[model samples]
Target: FMPASLLATGSERIVSGLFLGTALSISSVKIVAMVVREMNFMRRDLGQIIVSSAIIEDTIGWVIIAITIGIATHGRIELASLAFTLAGVAAFMAFSFTLGRRIVFDAIRWTNDTFRSEYAVVTVILAIMGGMALVTDLIGVHTVLGAFVAGILVGESPILSRHIEGQLRGVITALFMPVFFGVAGLSADLTVLVDPELALLTVALVAIASLGKFGGAFIGAEVAGMSRSEGIAVGCGMNARGSTEVIVASIGLSIGVISHTLFTMIVTMAVITTLAMPPTLRWALGRLPMGEAEKKRLEREEVDQRGFITNLERLLVVVDEGVVGRFAAYLAGVIGAGKPTTVLRTSGESEADPVEAAHLDEIEKGAEQGREAAKEADEEPAHEAPLTRRTHDAPLSAEAVAKEARKGYGMLLIGLGRAVTAKGGFSRRLNEVAGAFEGPLCLVLKPAGVGRQMPRLGPGSGRILVPVNGTANARRGAELALAVASVTGAPVKVLYVARPGRDEPRDTVSHRRREAVLKDIVALADRYGVEIETAIRSRAAAADAIARQAGRNVALIVMGVARRPGEELIFGETTSGVLQRCPCPVMLISDARLRRDDEGREALRSGTGTG
Candidate 1:
């Protein structure tokens, strides 16, 4: 800046230097993420730190660039121009994050739910981007600011699932990225570099850009108490300006803030730095070894990647105005935590019922509790608002509920008062509701004598009993139990019932498999920051073992059962025995598979189905 300003005659010096420095100082978040991902470091501590720093830098740089452009357009710095630009940008940011964010979220959600057209959400999102960009232009700033803000808010929306994100990204990658880069590339004239003076100046620009970025990042990392290797990796990671710099240079050139020669130099510097970063960053990261704790954390995250409960995008809760209904809602809130939840109040529950109001309050409290626990356990917990609605137009029916389920729910939870019959079998209504949704289901049942008061599911209540049979369903149940226990501060006991008289061979496949199952559950509990006690019963029957555990200070029994091929809502003998014998409330999680054979239909018509 000093050298460039001194060389200028008078007025152009300050603006030229500021624009030049701002252009050079910018770091590209896209390039940083790309390099980090290529090296499989996205989840590691080093990669996270590097990527986060680049994002912060990019955000701040854009703001500075906006201010610079505002000044450059005026030909010189003026208090009124600076003040208007700063005030407009600040006001826009405040509104964007507050009311604007809420409005956008609601709009996107409504579009997703209301539209049956393909790519409706994507269409709405693009429109939102344009609207926001127009707002920034109206405020006398670049539209990119508004577009950037809109992208952040939209990405944070809970409904923007991985599938939808892929669709959006696919469109952008296929259309926008190439077009933008191609235009930017065509605007630059590399022939300017043929002159010896210009060639030397470009080299100087690259050196200045790289050294400034690397030194700043290295010093900052050191100040932050990072290790030497980590600091080196970060410095290398931050030096890539990549496509962000190209965009910045284009903006500068478009607004007459920079000449074509300088623009070409900036673009050249960007290309060189970006192409050099990945290999350098890879080398630095490879020299850094993972510690035991980091290794464990990585393994836990891997489990989470494949775990059923962890990957659930949204929850569909169908509950009534009963104790069981409220409990189910509370459980749903806990398990779904920061994920979007749609609570469909079963028809026939009075809208003015005090129990219904209480149920809503319980859901909020449960969600808050789960959020707090997540804050303690996760480095970056999601803060998405849960979505809830009720239907009073029609009574609860299989067809109506299934219609709601078609909107892409990860799991469905049902808790109706008449879920069980006098003969201890699942009621006909319960079977119909369960048969409607073809996904995982959680059915909550309140015991016969339990009153209107909510059960103490939190601390001081008792332990949570989760029985794992080494199946995927059983592991899912364990994950659900862990989530509840994490929020409630309750101890969890994993009960594994071994077949009696099994061959007692060490290191056998069956034995190792059992050990592995228990080990996986333990790792899962550790991930939730919850301690669990494991119990193995080799002699007692599976049901008896589970029932006995339920009696020992257990507040609730959560079981994962496979749907049996029958007309009735049967989950095999073990589940039935435990449900009949367990003294506490039992929650069953099962896949949505109903064997609807001709004989099964006749059995249902004859009302001759068992639980």
Candidate 2:
């Protein structure tokens, strides 16, 4: 219907109507993103479909508009011109997704490490976008497609997708978006409505575009297994042709594919249709009830949105050249894959010092191995983001570490010798270091090497042991353990320490409490797709119970402990004893007080291995 009506509108300019029609048919991504976010349905099933379809529509619409203009310039859609348009588009898309994807990811990662300066990555991304846009223009397609593809690649780079998003979003929202939209409005003359013939033609044009877009989206939804009601809601939601339509019309006018009269009509149609969308979408969405699966998925995503480890952007490792340091590097590698990481060795030794050099080498080796493990598991890309081999020879003092910590690191991984004193109290030096940082800390503890254990299983895979005692610290420990296990696809054991005889007998009450704790841990592990085994040990000492349970199968033990004020991280007896005697490595995840003001970035303090 749209094609026939467009054909009927012109004799000399047959493809002009086609260009205008395509421009009018596009649904705006900016409009859909705003409305869905305002309604807080951005993560809903239908909402995602609508946004995704808009992205596709925007791409396809630009391609069509570009080609139609080319045909209009040549005065005819010759067979050769048609073939060239099809081939150019196909080749452009193929290169964008394949080799272009790799080049973009690698360039972004390289820029981050080489410059080591702020916004180096942002500079690289913009350059890539501009270069790609020029390439598209040279190929006779619209620059918008190139810019759009560049955005996809930039978003995929894990170095700082979140940080980059925050930075770019602010710049675009505060400056670029308003300027562009405002200029578009200024260029559109609404006085064209005074001409009755043009006004009637404009009305007909809008009607054809609206009905066609609405019907196409509705049919697509139904074909993709959505209900009839969902199809209706999607159609209503997609009727907006706001900013994208305006941009398309502006481009067409500049290229002579559309006249001032047609551009004004299209812009007016865009304003009317866009204004009509939000309320109609709200009403339609209000009638579409949420399903159980969607509700559960959204709830899970909400939990992740608030989670600590889930949001960690970068890592800073302050360690010594020891078994603990190498192990710390390994953990950081697994957890910090595709994230910027800086490793600092505190030995304060010269490059000539063999021990210092060996420790640094070992730490980097372990980190590389861990990253490989993550890559094999498809957890993240290897050698992307801040994959640093640059270890500073600087002193591991609070002043030294804190200076680096202030430079945009979210988590600090501290590994050291003598974390616990002879009396089972945290070493004063550890506290002094940990006191400097206000961010969360992961203290890596190297376990006692009691017996020569057998090496088995695949690379980066290991069994993790976590002790649960219904404490917040314990939950944090289990959370960390679950994350590691999830990344490495390792098995986890959740051991509950039941004292020798507390008289909380194995009756229904005690049993139920124990059951609840284990159930919670199991559920947490399940969320990460990690396999877990639960156990209860009626033992005299919690530390001894946990230590004894760390058999040959367990590769690491993660303990969560609260920090007691004064001078040290006081874990009472259980944690201190675990540090003293456990045969497997113990990682203590402590919730440091995270302070922040109005800015989105976090304030971090210097950290030590005791916490």
Candidate 3:
């Protein structure tokens, strides 16, 4: 069929056959990934294999396609040309995954943090993709390879937020994808298939493609220890060619490697296979039952997916270069791991603000302390988001924050030198700080002498304490505590303070509720691979119990509480009490947005000011 099809063109049948085989064998990564994601099977084990295999097929297929493209560009297939293209591709991929990887991440992070313009990061991403595509074309390979590689690199960037990802995804899915496939459809004259001979060829082309891909995937699955039914499903899943076929045929047509009739046949085959794929793959996927292990893993992944801190897109740090500022830097670095963070450095408190008068000496030393803490944070994993320090010459104010807020930070973290301000100690600064952002908040308060001791902190191999209630905020705090503990290999102590009740021990009064809370937090710690301990304080106030635990040589105290809207950042009496007397530094984390009603959210968005 290959020789007969190419007789008019007088091209080498063997080379044309190689191109046809490569094109037919490749599956569409975009098409398959979209279907899998739509079905919500992305985290399933079988789904993982199918998508990963398609990715592998796309990669190998592109390398082969690049070689052929190189031949077509030079008007002939030759050994020297093939080897040169292969060498160029090899070098390109090696450099791309290495230095190119770093460059791409840095470019995206820098653009995201440095620019205040809307969609600036999205524009930068598109530029990176186009730039890489041009590089591949200049190196005598297909630009498709560069574009595909670029997508992979961009997808892997830690700083890539859900909002940005979804935005890019929308453009591709709604506009570019439809346009590409629509253009392919318009270019393909199915009228060529009206001839009996060409119609027969299209049918044969689909059969050959379907069988070869199915057989290859089926055998691979079986060899990798899947059951017979699983292998059959894998074979069915791999049969789709979709857009990959159209793109390959288009490329071949443009380069004169295939005549118009052959291009039409390929496009017809693509349309048929793609149309038949969804129902077939869906049926096969439905037939495969989930194993116990897969179920548990998926459930755990789902929990992590919904977790508050885990989903944070970006962090805003407002601090001075003071002792407490340094402490906030360290905590932010720990929690902000992988999260893009912007630092707002207020040089010092204004002399007129009562905070400066209350803690004049301490405020003066904060800037130096913040620098050292930031330096220590830099010592953590380099793959995490790059911290951008926004230098401020004036005292921190809501208006300065309102400008950065336009850049879309998802959380606000405030750490300053003085615990008290003229407005009312801690709550005033928090009230002023949280006003500019419509997201969650974290407040890091330094204990009296913790500044001098902070340089000695944050290799955190000591015990960490977290007080847990069954509330969402408490769970979030426990999760954050577990994460910090996991990084430092510290043991976590879960405390539940129970007051006395009628005819029962104080701690025993709420034994059932305390047990449930402990159970949940312990599971959370297990997920993070951190050790956890549980305790109950009989007949005690929550603040007193937490403070006593913190006094027990605890490395850090993490309290999760909801923020209440008031004239200022007054969380509650218990939280305030704990902060006032706790000997160690305490971290107060809140999920203000989670509890907001529609009206409240509108108020927040309009900057009517809720913490």
Give per-residue CA lDDT, model 1, range 440-521, as digits (tens): 8898886554444656777778899999889988988898888889899988899887877555677788778888999999
Ranked candidates, highest TM-score first: 1, 3, 2
lDDT of 1: 0.82
TM-score of 3: 0.80
Candidate models: Cα lDDT each: 0.82, 0.72, 0.74
What does each candidate score in C-alpha RMSD? 5.5, 6.4, 6.4
Query: Which candidate leads in TM-score?
Result: 1
- For each of the candidates, give the backbone clash count: 0, 4, 5
- Better candidate by TM-score, 1 or 2: 1
Model 3: lDDT of residue 61: 90
Clashing pairs in 1: none
User: Where does the lowest 10-residue lDDT sum fall in candidate 3?
Assistant: 355-364
> lDDT: which is higher, 1 or 2?
1
As for TM-score, the candidate ahead, 1 or 3, is 1
Can you tell me which runs of candidate 3 are displaced by over 4 Å?
Answer: 3-12, 35-40, 191-196, 222-229, 275-296, 318-323, 341-385, 389-405, 420-424, 427-434, 447-463, 496-518, 535-555, 592-611
